[model samples]
Target chain A: MKRAASRLAALSLALLAGTPAALPARAQDAPPATRPSDDQAEVLAKVEKYLELAKSGTAAVRPQAARRLAQLGEPARARLVELAGADGAGLAELGPQVVEIAADFGDAGLRAALWRVLADADFPWRGSAARALAKAPVADEGAAFRGLGADHLWQVRFAALDALRALDLRDARAAVRALLVDQEGAVRRAAAALLVDWGEPGALRWLVEELRREDAYFRVPLGAQARFDAHKRLTELLGDDFGFRPGESPATPANAAALARLEAAARERAGDAWPSELPPIARAAGASTGDVLGLELRSCRAGEFYLRWNDADEVHVGTGNAAVVTLAPGTVERLRAGIERRVAELGDTRFWGEAGCDLEQYRCVGADGELRTWLLSKGQASEGDLRPAPLDAVAELLLLTLPDEASADPRLDRLRSRARAALSVLGGAL
Target chain B: MISLRSLLPALLLVGLGAAAPSAEDATVVQMVELNNVEYQIGDDLPDWVIALDGQRIEIAGFMRTGTLEGETWFDLTNDSCGCGTSKLQHFVRVTLESGTTSFTPDELTLTGTFAAGEQEDEDGFVESIYRLTITSL
Candidate 1:
């Protein structure tokens, strides 16, 4: 439980240091001289045995105890909950250790107990329960998130918000939007950032206004620069220079003038309904609702370049010549779907094996407003003859971007067909 | 090239100066220092690195072979697992003076002479930013 508390505090983004001992658990409220009866002693012994088996057992043996505990149903649930509510000294240290195992139980009765703890106004374990739920696959995800978000504690609320962000639940959009005015600065920041990521309509305006506030100052460290986090996100959403330079003070006369100019530009752009002529980054950040994608290629052997489709339906591939070609009608939507499918294949794994001389990189801006990059390399492992090879489809796409005279060789015809087959899943005459 | 024996006399005459390090003293160059963002992006290695050109130094990193055969002269990188994006200065060339030693997957600690420059092939792609002639491994 202590470790869970510390992890929650660190992930809160509230700029607060957590001391494990300072936070009291439910055991602190109980009378000191109370002794366990025979039934309670048996329950405690069984809980300890199950915890030990879960911790030290191998993959084959571990699931047996975990399953048995889950099958024990209500009795196991009650004992584990009591242990989790224990103080953070000696044996109580086991409280944090048993959370993942207990979650693996995935029993309805146990899950109900956890939900009760989460919803309980008197329980001091709400933060711990919310955090465990964030990692666990709960059945009533939407309802659990809603309840946790409304908790009185800021830490619990922040954890719930983070869970909502990771799940990217479209159904909970209204609830998430309500958190934009949260009392804690960290919660408000997280809410605004998640809204921007989902391409919500009013998110950009809220972010800009946050930066323009009189109390706004750089309180968080971002890379080499010390600008307000809102300002940084705004720059990422809009262009790098979004109408004004970030000066040292928000109250300075020069800064105020610059901000006025920025606000004027924003208001004018918003009035136009955000035409597609704006930058691709701006369009991805919800400035406009048309199709604009970023494509980048980097190689140790063939060199590096970026490609993007402009508002005029022209694709610019920077292949030494800055080559521009017009795409056929309906090709843009097909391309967007193609990119989305490719990104889904690269979820948690970006690159595999060691670096090789022949390395190729492919990047794309997905239709869902997220940027994805993948690396394909030819690598030989330490002891094996088996070597890793680059993706053939991506290599063919790369060849298409190069100059026609060099890439138009007849030998590439087979590969080109394969590449088109992979990229053109929508299947028309592009 | 100035021999290690010849640089010693010059160091004694110059006498323990902070600006110029003698060849006898082993300098340690961190990967973070070599990849400093302050350096200008260009074909040539910056002048600031030239101070440690001929000096012996010790560096620790992961080993990677240039070809499938796994030769003795390999590229050492900041990340052994090859998990993230890489830049030019993230690798240093290490050549074994005593010929091919067995390649090991573990992180290797090496002592060698540090050489700073940009070497390109006939196609003019940057081959390296730093090179080391191994004295010990």
Candidate 2:
């Protein structure tokens, strides 16, 4: 009976995070400690247990538990963020879960928790946490983010730049201004994006610069053997937060024309930059050598780190040119940027707004389309694969993901054989 | 060599020609319904994505199945692709419904048309996600 009651209490707490949790304190009312709200205690107790379990579950029962606690609402936010960011923390492992819980918390708790997350060492997690706080449910939520303008982790601090978009309070101008000069192109872009909205003094120039880097560094080629996090999208981008809603009106004619113009302009712009598309660093290697690629700052490769999006100028396997690519100096940096951008765009509430999908877990799918059994989790991407392969086709395939037992794994063998066989056939045709 | 520069003109020509000899502007696709079977992300990975079931779905141009969900539905029609190349058709996934009543399936393919946005406004990053007729199992 007690367990059932506790479970019910936890469930209620989860629901409270979404709807209002009756924050009835008329300034004269007593605090929880004095009154002993039975509900808060039950939730706290259950949530603590959930956090502990979140550490050991095999297929991720614990992560789900943390999510449930998140649903319980505001009171649990402090606990959730604390545990999710524990020292020697596995931010990547706990990233998706932390974001999930953060999204579930109320503005009061979220605003504070998101602040701490902004300075976290982990880029992926910080980015996720920042994006969550961007659309925070309350006003003046920018305080925590303001200090993050100079966080140590590049991605984490970068996320702080992104957080400014929705949380751009008048007082937060200093933070946004500082980020505008950030070394990372993504940081500058986010800072500029917010400046555009805020109409800050001299932000467009910075935005343009960031945009320049975005286009130039966007599609730098992958080296012969480059492996990045292929499981980020699986955890962060995937999920059921299907952004569609009912009762949406039809698109206006003007809207159609505008979208077309954007498409055409993007094409023209990408084409113009085809010659020097990538940064010089990315161009130093194999198939990625001197490809006329353009860039767009979005997520790819499982939303892990960004990929300097390099393109083959519309090279199609069947279009006679099996595969050709070019790269520049910052191709790898651009790739990393893509990952960062993708991580931030997931739940902006600005573009898709209320329509973003509810993020769940991450997964890994191969070229032939198979969800990798393990190594798909967000945590795995952060610290697991430290060895970088040489640049090459086999390298490209390997980068899609690294099999646990490269020799014994059927997925790796299948990918290797198919890629080799395909390349061989293509090479023969060439 | 046919560069993307050259290809765009050709693609534009095709687009303009496809507008018909009726001396008028051009046309388009959207996802409306499904029933009885499971939702498949794409032909290659035939698995149901439950979140998209029944609920109206909207997505970007190119989509790969990931465990995380937000904008879970991305239509791979011409302009929607992030790749800006032949869509791997790989950027595909579908939500399934069980028998007309609920969405539950082993595998289902998404077939839909998107409301192409106009290309003229300053704040015109607008693309409205529309109805997807569910083909449930």
Candidate 3:
């Protein structure tokens, strides 16, 4: 995933020349062009400053500025939109420039300007504003949505369909739903998508009908001409040195091996490690509460723990894959040791009997107090549900998991060994 | 018996697949956004929503509101494999004998039920389907 994300970043940078990693698509593809660093920034500053003079800027200036800003992508667009969002005397100065910018940059600006225009009802600007928003990468979704809910113009209402179709805000489901009855076919199409994204009950009924009706993606096998066309297009995506041998398919074994090696090297980073050491995915677990470590895996299953906050009152909390422990001042240190010891013990154990379960999907759980020692089963076990294993037995289990001098992820077992010892001390303290 | 025109598009309804919907006699065909999966009939078909829940949905107004024009076949399964999950599809083509047989130009309620879906690759919002159901009304 890390490699994939970096590759994506590299591809985007390639599309947008001049940055930290701006290697042209091909050396030959590099154009004889050079641009100053702040060239884009200067135009943007002026656009903000030239709001009153939006129409007055040199024909080339604002258009270039808007185009450059679009290239700055979402981060820049987000900043501009946010500035517009903050209302004040600055709006009048900002408004017209925004209008012109959206119009000037074509589809890109149109998408950016959609949200701001949705906030205003001023006519000529509003209509163009809406159209700009729909140019391609959609915008103005939330505003048009809020308006269409009570809008008078069916044209505007119809445009609402387009607005919804273009708008991709995750939280705007409410606004989208309000336009469900829009009087235009375009509007209905927008509604279908919104309903589907948000999983509205009605959207399904409608989609099922549409699905049965539409077959747009893939059809029958292509004819000879189509196949040739596909081949031509596919070649465009092929890299240089694609055909290792004269006229040989670029997808041959030797080339494939080289490409695989390059890809592997490119994607060397691993994902962030999961936090298995952290107990109770929640916060605040204490010895006083019979709160066992609680972890909830995925969204489906849940677990609970009954831990005592201190030496007195019993605290019970159930969590799976996560927990919160609120131990007394010294409790943390002691339990950390206990947990480490237990991990070492568990690791050393030969066979883990899950009764009837996949051990991979299970984990070791334990809790103890001064009076009673509780060993939890891999699945869900409660206060009285523990079966005590000898401390040596537990140590044996830990040894099994612990790595020798040359293993990977060895730290996990090592950490467990140390944590279990502290846990035992804490249990004895209580 | 429903023709492939309407019945076939029913198969494409899983996830967000196409913008140009099938069905020659589209009682309603307008673009809309699937914001929230407001309500679903059965299982994990989170893409659909119900208008009765008062969730606002964006839609292009369709001139024709469908009623049980006649018995039209409907598919019950949302799985990509085409397995039927409910008895619902059997009745879709079977002239939906319901009160929602017709629609007004005004954004009408997609009362049957709906499911929201993923977004499209192009410039449109996500696709949603409103399975208009007909009760004794």
Candidate 4:
């Protein structure tokens, strides 16, 4: 199996290596006269300023800057390309943003630049290129996605799958099917999601299997949103009861039941060929607490999602417009224990709040019907009207109920990770 | 011709006589100043921001209504549209101290107590980041 996996990886690398050096449809194919009109020097300077703001400026500045650059259109493309290719300290950070900015042009230069980045095997920004290309609405979508879908890098492959799914390319079904059993859960989930979007029976079967696995958590690094998308797709394909919650840990009975129901539904929809019995949850070594806990984290604009423990013995998690649905079981006792131990370990660690970031509040109603709430700021602030992360047990419980904030804000995610780390620290006086 | 959009804010600031107000008095806070992106991802906040807490402050932005139509509070965003509800980092929730107003596209300048922290609704949502109990608009 290891050898086979290695061989598959090698084959994927080989396929990526064999991609065409240049697409016939690219802007660079034209003569030098085809180069886009450059912006006025002052305008270019403004564009540069916005670009800088988009990178390291204030939140208010970043989005506005990005919007300005996008509105500037082709005038900003050349500079964006230059920044994307620069070897400066933070230039690489601009790759994804550049790709997004490039999409506004939807011109040949965007296509050409993306192709150049993706075709070059050693390109530092291949992942960004793939992601950008996926959304670029290129003329030759099939060849681009086909070449990239077999990329050695999991990110590139995932992007390719995303592109295929978005484009609804029927021919790429075989390639997408191959990724169903990928080594990475994200890749597999992406592949399954693509299939589900395409309404393929194979996707139904694959998702059911994922629901049955021991490590059923559909966590993909920086991909809680994608996982949520797949869960929604699955629920749509199966019955309403089969809807999977995005942030809910897949270890819950409600999730298991949902998966089981989904599997049965898939069998009915796709025929009896699909597997019937998914792997059952193994009992923990010690006596487990059947206590269920619900946690939620919401920010004003950039973050709004919750994981509520419903009376139906299910975790109801919501991301975007999707209705609250069951996910795998959450580790309520373990999480509470982790919070308690960490709070005890670090006596009186100060918690601070920020001006722009949203307040993260965690609420857990105990089995005894005692409701407690903990309000946490995204980060530690020294002087502001601040609420500390688990400033007390109530606060800690709120931090524990962190649903993946898919607000597309890295700051919120980092705050969630920080809260989890602070709560998970076993011991050591600070 | 020069695009007036970029220069408009500077011109407005000049008109408003942008000056540092005393801590006991009112301070002017721009969305850019409040939502500076330079801060690191974790919980540690910059000290300069801590100084702004509990201060009477003034800010300018576009006004937006809350999730529910009849809700008394509205939001102020850097963008004129004030469209998206997520990313609280880019907006300030504004509650009028006196009368209520409908949503408007034009930028509105308001004065209020700049309250900052995590405030959750009964339904478990972060209601605001920078909230202003508006004394004037």
DockQ of 3: 0.03
Cα deviation of B125 in candidate 2 (Å)?
28
Name the runs in model 1 displaced over 4 angstroms. A1-82, A85-113, A136-139, A212-228, A231-248, A251-430, B1-137
Kept native contacts, fraction for each prediction: 0.06, 0.00, 0.00, 0.00
Compute the DockQ of candidate 2.
0.05
Docking class of 3: incorrect
Weakest ten-residue segment in model 4 chain B by summed lDDT: B79-88
Q: What digit string (tens of lDDT, one per residue) describes model 2 on residues A1-430?
A: 4334433344445444444445343312434334326666566766666655443331124345555667766455555544444431433455344554565566443445555544544334455565566555345546666666766434556656665555546567777766654544445556655664564423433322221111112122111001111111111222221221111111335433433443344334335432323222221222222222121112221121222222322211101011222334554344433433442333322111111111111111223333211111112222322111211222243233322224332222333344333322211110
In the range A43-115, model 1's lDDT, one tens digit per residue, is: 4455546666544432222334444555565556655544554331222233323443455455444455556
Ranking by lDDT: 4, 1, 2, 3
lDDT tens digits, residues B24-56, model 1? 566655543464423322655545466557767
Where in model 2 is the C-alpha error above 4 Å?
A1-71, A74-97, A100-124, A131-147, A150-159, A162-190, A193-430, B1-63, B67-137
Query: Among these predicted structures, which one has the highest TM-score?
Result: 4
Best by lDDT: 4
lDDT of each: 0.48, 0.34, 0.31, 0.50
Give DockQ per model, in order.
Answer: 0.03, 0.05, 0.03, 0.03
Off by over 4 Å in 3: A1-66, A72-122, A127-144, A152-178, A208-430, B1-137
Q: How many backbone clashes does candidate 1 have?
A: 1
User: Could you give me the TM-score of model 4 versus the true structure?
Assistant: 0.41
Model 2 lDDT, full chain set = 0.34
Error of 2 at A358 (Å): 18
* Chain A only TM-scores, each candidate in turn: 0.34, 0.36, 0.23, 0.48
